[model samples]
Target chain A: MSIALYFFAGLSAAAALGVLLFRQVLYAALSLLACLLSLAGLYIVMQAEYIAVTQIIIYAGGILVIILFGIMITSRLAGKPMQVSTQYPVIGSLLALLIFCALVLSQPAVTSHTSDFSTNHWQRAGRWLMTEYALAFETTGVLLLICLIGAAVTAIYQRES
Target chain B: MSPVLLYLSFLLFALGVSVVLTKRNAIVVLLGIELILSAAILNAIHFNQQFPDRMDGQLFALFIIVIAVCEAVVGMSIIIRVYRYYQTAVPDQINELNER
Candidate 1:
């Protein structure tokens, strides 16, 4: 299990790096899909089956599709690989590296305590979400509705000359 | 296989960010942002497993997914409108609003 956990973590990190280094938009999008799917797999490895499924459905299935469709609709595909300006490359890379190092250093040392990854815990999560977190859940729905209306208005409203 | 998988995910995330930062295409930038958000979600779930008593990480991941969808929709709409007015989707080319 430890080996599997480490493997998933490394895979996720690599995909994240791909996201940061890829030059082409389409390839980058594909890489993003790969990253999201891998994250879902990591969720499964972490014993969060519900999160894994949601990650797959909402991110890999839904959001990725919407982004791909947007790219298709925009028709801004590049003919050549985009170039990064060299003026601040060293500073930017150093900053990113520093942040990554900080994240790694901040992680708590792994302990020997092993959790019993079972179905009961999942049920507990469901109950808690429905009861304790219900308000937040409801608010999310409202937020989605508002986003939909706002998007429609923004897309449809024409500017007057 | 596990290490390989984790490395792969990291690579994807880095590539996505690069696209978002370097690409002139607005939609591509949005895609990159989505990739970054998913990376954060993955990290949360990983930590959640290590501490099962709290389901906060998973819940947060769920919320992040919802927000990502909302951002994509609204972002795409904004991009469409920008394209309609500017006749181009390249960020560099849409500088009419910039003050000289």
Candidate 2:
């Protein structure tokens, strides 16, 4: 299980780098899919089963498709690789590395303890969402509705000159 | 286990920040934001593992995921509108946001 966790972590990191490195929008979108899937796998390894499933269904299935459609519709570089302009790669990388090192150095040494991975994550999550988090869940629904309407209006505004 | 997980999430978050900083394309910028959001989800779930019975972290992660989807939808629609109007999706070249 730990080995699987490490494997998915590496895969996700590599795919995330691909998302950063790809010069074309389509390629970057594809890399994002890979990253999301690997992250889902990592979630499963960490006993986050419901989150893993949600990650796959929502991120890989839904969001990725939306991004791909956006890429196809908005960009005129169809069938041709469009060069994405990236500035200050060296400085950006240096800053990121600094942040990474700081995070690593700040970590306290692990206290050895056996993790209890009993399988009620989904049940409890559902209960809390329905009970304690019911208000938040309803708010999310409202937000989603607003987003849907807003997106449609914005996309179809069709300003007349 | 926790230390390694924290490190991975931090690394991912940093990479996402770099992508946001360096990429000029609007879609790529959105992708960077998504990456950062996912890194945060990973952290939330990791913390949840510490107390498996309490579902607050996982529930919040789920909420974050939903919000992220909504964000991406709205952001992509806006990007489409920008592309239609300006005929390009590169942020640096879009002068509409700049003060004249």
Best by lDDT: 2
Q: What is the TM-score of chain B in candidate 1?
A: 0.83
Best by DockQ: 2
Candidate lDDT scores, in order, read 0.68, 0.86
TM-scores of chain B, in order = 0.83, 0.93
Worst 10 residues of 1 chain B by lDDT: B1-10
lDDT of 2 by residue, A52-139 (tens): 8999999999999999898888778667776688989999888888988888888665442334766576677788889999999999
lDDT (Cα, tens digit) per residue for candidate 1, span A1-22: 7677676666666666665666
- The reply for model 1, stretches above 4 Å from the true place, is A76-90, A110-113, A157-161, B1-22
Model 2 agreement with the true structure over B1-100: per-residue lDDT tens digits: 6777888889899999999888888889999999999989988887776665577888889999999999899999999998888898886778876899
> Residue A65 of candidate 1: its Cα lDDT?
81
TM-score of 1: 0.81
Q: Candidate 1 — what's its lDDT?
A: 0.68
Task: Give the runs in model 2 whose Cα sits over 4 Å from its true position.
Answer: A108-118, A157-161, B96-100
**What proportion of the true contacts does each candidate reproduce?**
0.51, 0.75
